[model samples]
Target: MDNLAAEQATDWRIDWQAPWLAALRELGQQAHGLVQAGATVASGLQYVKQAHGLLPGWQFVDQQQLPVGQAYEAFICNQRCIPTRNNLHDFFNGLIWLHWPNLKQQLNALQAGEIESQGVGAQRGRLRDSITVLDENGGLLLAPQALCDALREKRWQDLFVHQRELWAQAQFLPIGHALLEKLVQPRKAITAHVICVPMVQAPAMCTVEAADAWLSEQLRSASCNLVNKPYLPIPVLGIPGWCLQNQNFSFYDDSLVFRASRTA
Candidate 1:
């Protein structure tokens, strides 16, 4: 389907009982505030991970090869990831540093061995709602109270009604098929930097246009010989290699940044 048509069909109707239905608005506001404060992109994401754990499906991995730091676990069924526990912890970690600067030093001292990295089992309370929303093909069509119960009790593992509907409609079109296939693909994640931003500094960010320009220029100036080229071309023909259309970038408050990893 065309972009306009797809958007029209993409209902923003809230399922009232969705776990985040109440806090979604506030999340938006807080994210915006962080952006306006000149927080870097990484910082904003860290903030969200803390405020709404696992909801956005983010995961954190440290670049270093320490067994504990290298591969932190996350739940990314299909192509979506909920969010990183490390980052959520980092939000509080940063706070502790603010109150007692020495605490950061103490933590850093144990960075290699002292920090214990482990997986947080998907919280049953939150997962219940997610599974419900994504499971029942007709779950979303049910009464708000019924839906609320499913979400509250963590009973959302059934076929998500909305996703099922999307899959059905997508089956008829090649493009839809391709998109759905991509969405369903098993996730392959990598370790990348997590730039942390505080809630206080996420508002007065560079305009999208300005950031785009800046990022493009940064890419253009990179030494082509360097294996790590900054920008990639979007999968479109007849476009210059330098066109900054290949990747996706977003903002949370004023803190918006992109992931650059050892692989890239």
Candidate 2:
């Protein structure tokens, strides 16, 4: 069997109750229910499009629908359909599109614009590479300046332990579909390239829709700086309340996963 078919045959399960998946539980459960009913990724996404009334007229189409020699982003931009495979990767991608349509649209536009300026070259160039990284493994970190500073500086102990209570005031949303897929089988080394959102007020007060809107604006304003990969590597499990292993103070002692900041 081909890779896609093999992947479809695999029994895929998502524990929505998992602490790591708490942030995405609502949407995850919806998608999980559809998949459990034996819906393919494209079909499930089509259902979501109808139910949620997804904007920009984006629809999920089979990967085969994507023409040969056509870039995925460019195709989505021109055709208004996302090429999806029947796998966990595309399943989570569909869920993200439902939750953050504006962000997904913006990312696609940036990618398509890049491809237009510079044809599908062997090298994707800096902007395209950065955009891909964000789409695949990014996180949105809405926290106070202090917590953000601690994280950006690689002060794991300060950010995850000392300021543990502060986490209640913050919100960290996993924006990358690949990151969500990886968390299905929780691992200690699972990290996210967290983009810090500038918000002094407690993020817990902001609704999911409000947070999504704020994040979309932030990304739009900083599209250029993305080329520099201005993101902090965060060991997601270390976040307080996300994992049982991290409850102990010694969890941050692993230098391999939570490495110290490099010298200038």
Candidate 3:
């Protein structure tokens, strides 16, 4: 299948989040029972992470020499959030935040050990998927070199300010994907590309549509190819409270509760 189709298909299992919870509880119970019964529990933890998104609480180093920890499982609450965990019970128990207290408080509680770890690591990334947009002149604005140049020049302070303002007003749209070679020089002109990060917002249902629209328009203006699927959810670790006020957020299923919505 093509890249666009591939990315969309990757989320096929997301819908299973609802029903799989019960079965996962059983599996975790059995595995913990087995581990408590003297089994090493290596494979069992992997099983739990796979079935439930709970990881074994370990680490792996990438080529960049950065250490990446394992998360048990991941779920998309909206277009731009996924929280991973290492334990099944802790992951499920987080659902309690949906009713009382608030997600932020729950997360704080989880961090403070008021909630269990479930062996999951919170891994979040930016720039969820790609999109293509058209500039006012109808020319594809293919040069991210401008952004790169701005960064190298230490003009990021200005750029960030501008981007932050634009993001406040614009929503991104998804376009189809192009080949990797299309992302580079010479051949990049062959087809347009759209890359986008969601307009960060709070964890509420009302903001969902607005966030989606702003992202779409911004991506289209940039002449990039929008991926057309749900925006890739970024993890909300250490993100400023203001950013979360309007964008969708989710981490581990239990933490998928909605936040207060913002007005346009």
Candidate 4:
């Protein structure tokens, strides 16, 4: 299915008892207003560029205020993105900008470079396509290198079973509703583009406060290359404690939200 059809099919409707649900709902409400106002996804992006809020290293600006050029090229050049009432696609894009502006800018930079070099084509190549796919429907895990190593290697006992404390130190920020939806009924496709942020400072024992603090720090720290080249995506189900439906430390394993990446 295309982006819009899939978005229509998606349950962007959040009914969570999560701590971060308020923020998610706030963004949803903002984007929902546009949709309710009879906005189409594509045109909806054009409408919300009226802000001047400073987010980390970037500032929100209208595309009309930017230099004249191809639409995508102009957006990239100005280091800007739009929020659309259009489908969950751009709405989620806007949500990401609200939640993680620095990363959104980074992704836009990469996309701009592609458009600049490739003459703003109607289509995208693998790198650009992969990046777009990732932005639209990716989940991110932020943890130190060692914890990541164990998770990647499926060292479940060491990571979640024996030393469960190590597993809690990480952050799970799902990028797309589709990713979360897929978690309810997981398919390999939903597991396709997992993004990792290597935070050496993350504590061994993850607390809600520490995770929040670390994410805040990441948000402020000047943009970094959050993903690697060729994008080594991880299996969403394979997140150590995430899919292990058994006794010992079953908070994640037994939870219905196995696919829910808690992106605060």
Highest-scoring model, TM-score: 2
Estimate, for each residue in 34-107, the C-alpha lDDT of model 3 and write its tens digit. 43443333433334445544322322111122224422122121111224232222222222212111222322
Q: Rank the candidates by TM-score, best first.
A: 2, 4, 3, 1
RMSD of 1: 22.9
lDDT per residue as tens, model 4, 67-153:
455565346446544523334544555555666554566566767776778866767776677666667666566776776665555
> Worst lDDT window (10 residues) for model 2?
1-10
In candidate 1, what are the lDDT values of residues 158-244, reduced to their tens digit? 112322232221111001111112222212121111111122232222232232233224224641111231112111111111113
* Residue pairs with backbone atoms closer than 3 Å in model 4 (clashes): 41-86
Worst 10 residues of 1 by lDDT: 169-178
RMSD of each: 22.9, 2.6, 21.3, 8.1
Tell me the spans in candidate 1 whose CA falls farther than 4 Å from its real position. Answer: 1-22, 45-264
Clash number for every model? 41, 0, 53, 1
Question: What lDDT score goes with residue 157 in model 2?
Answer: 86
RMSD of 3: 21.3
Candidate 1 vs candidate 4: the lDDT winner is 4
